[model samples]
Target: MDARWLILADDLTGAADCAIAFRRRGRAAAVIWGETAWDEEVPVLSYDADSRGLAEAAAAQRHAALLQRFHTAGRRLFKKIDSTLRGHPAAEIAATLAPLRAVHGHAFGILAPAFPGTGRTTVDGRVRVGGRPLEDTEVWRRDHRYETAELGAMLATAGLASRVLPLETVRGAGLAGALAEAASVPDRIAVCDAETDDDLSRIAEAGLAMDAAPFFIGSAGLAHALAASAPPQGLDPVRIGPDGRGALFVVGSMADISRAGARRLVAEGAVLHLPVTPHTLLADADGRAGLAAQVAERLAAGGDVLVEIVLAGEPDMSLGLRLAHALADALASVAGEIGALAATGGETAAALLTRLEIRGIHLADEIEPGVSLGLTLGRFSIPIATKAGAFGDADSLVRIRDRLRKARTEGSLT
Candidate 1:
């Protein structure tokens, strides 16, 4: 019960979803950025490296630096990667194992990015999303760093030795022994196959029984299994904040899932859509102010507002970062009026939080699979929910908005 775990992720949503795995299990979990101080009482610490959009070398470097500071004794390490293999998993895995090898004399990383609840599974060492090969998915076609969907090949490209533990081995009774045998070899990483949460739980049981310090690499599914395997500490119940006057929903992703969710919200009449174009955000300061005033007035009138970055035709992917920051800056003027915040994409959430001078978040619960609900820690201490751009369905946003509304009606403010 005294053991601690650190979940390091490439983005904010990844960090929160994984950290919530522990928080939901009666453990104190927090998601923080930079070298900000963490409460020692919390058993789980998830940090966002914010390297998903960076170059391979830069992403690896960022992971290496963060591991140097957080990879301390008595704490288990979990490297949270994208379930669709969108980020630099191979390079980041290498960086995560470096410190372990230096300190423990041997390092074994188990990579299993399967979230069955969300239709992401690993079989034969290849990642699949919604029954299709990852490469065939819209997310991959739009942006993917891997040449192949095979986990072994991806690791091999990064100059790391990897082996696949087939599903038969994963579900067998000898799983613990097989895992121990795999860990005996130095610098060897295994991409374990999993199709269900039970399979992931079996993997967690085996990995936790190993004598050496094992490094975990996966998405929220594996994190949930590992968290469940830990002994309960009887932590305090997490408090969900009550709704303020109204809610502010920010959508900055072009992913199909996010777009659908925005459209669903509009259809349900749950939120008033306030679309701002990139040109106005970048070139027109007064136009930005006008948009902010409109949003604030809506919030003051007790109406939920959904502000999205609108684009005509196909979007230029290169303008994503600039547009995210511009939109976030323009929205900061109404930070005080934002009673509750819901952001769709990681970059948008990070930028908006930075502009609002918020340092960290204490995760309370999960609104749905891959969507996390929490309260901000620093200056803007309000209720917030974060969701990955492509993780949820159309009804996901409506569900989140309804939860915040219920919390307000029930007077659950902490």
Candidate 2:
């Protein structure tokens, strides 16, 4: 009951996934964003700073300000970064360390950005996705803020000194001592390489045992590790079930993984598939309303509906955010009929939920590695699930749909 956790994520999906990590382990957790009023009584609180699409300096400033505003003496801090090293991770990490140093005399960060279940790992101080170097991955090519994938080099960009704790050190008996020594210098970050959940667990355990507890920095993998190490709080978690309405899916990511998943889900023919084009999203209000009306009609009839953005040929990457927001706008009209909601990508989730006037989500389960199931808070309490753009397999969306369907039929999460 004494352990309070504050997870700061740069995007909505990251916030929900990290918060659900704690929730899965019996802690009361919620994800909030954009001035949302959070319950202080909740043992775990994850805040989406929505800085993933910002410039490096702006992302850093946002993280610094958020940390200063939310960090309390009793609450432990977890900085959630993208597994692929997207956004301004180094700048954000440095920003996080600054305030922690001012508050705790000396602050150190333990960075382990590995989500093995999703094929993201750090080896030889370099990040790899699906056994390929991060820089060689499509995700990095499509969206990246750094020139290299070397953890130490990336951290150095922000003037923070870092040393890589090789997998051997992480698995060795001297890990605790090594971490304590590595973090002895102020503003130092220990970048640990992890290829498995066990390695991450060891790193989490060692960091927690340090003389001066270091702030954690990682994706959902490390969050899961820390959550496993935490003592149970016995708080009642928010549960979600079917509300006798149809499910709504919003897919806004152009990533291949998400695209393929959406295709598979549509191919199954279980839901009414509506493909929306970029031009349609950018068009007049009438076009948008027409799409929303069609979706609402299906939902009103108790039919599952999938609204996906279809990017034909090569798209202008610059318009990704704009298109996501526009898609959210087009779907806003159907929020009231949404019994269960699942959204892919952070931008789409944030924009759509904000439009729905939902202040936050009370996490219920981790449906998949990086997919989170929760209940919306604010205008409605329907079941909602969120996933990062590049976290799941081709069948990920299908699984999410099945989970939501079960929740609806069973009236509770198992």
Give the per-residue Cα lDDT of candidate 2 at 300. 85
lDDT of 2 by residue, 132-151 (tens): 99999889888887889999
Which candidate number maximizes lDDT? Answer: 2
Best TM-score among the predictions, by candidate number:
2
TM-score: model 2 vs. ground truth: 0.97
68: Cα error in model 1, Å: 1.4
Count clashing pairs, candidate 2. 1
User: What TM-score against the true fold does each predicted structure earn?
Assistant: 0.96, 0.97
The local distance difference test score of each candidate is: 0.87, 0.88
Least lDDT summed over 10 consecutive residues: which range in candidate 1?
A: 405-414
lDDT of 1 at 235: 58
Candidate 2 residue runs with Cα over 4 Å from true position: 233-242
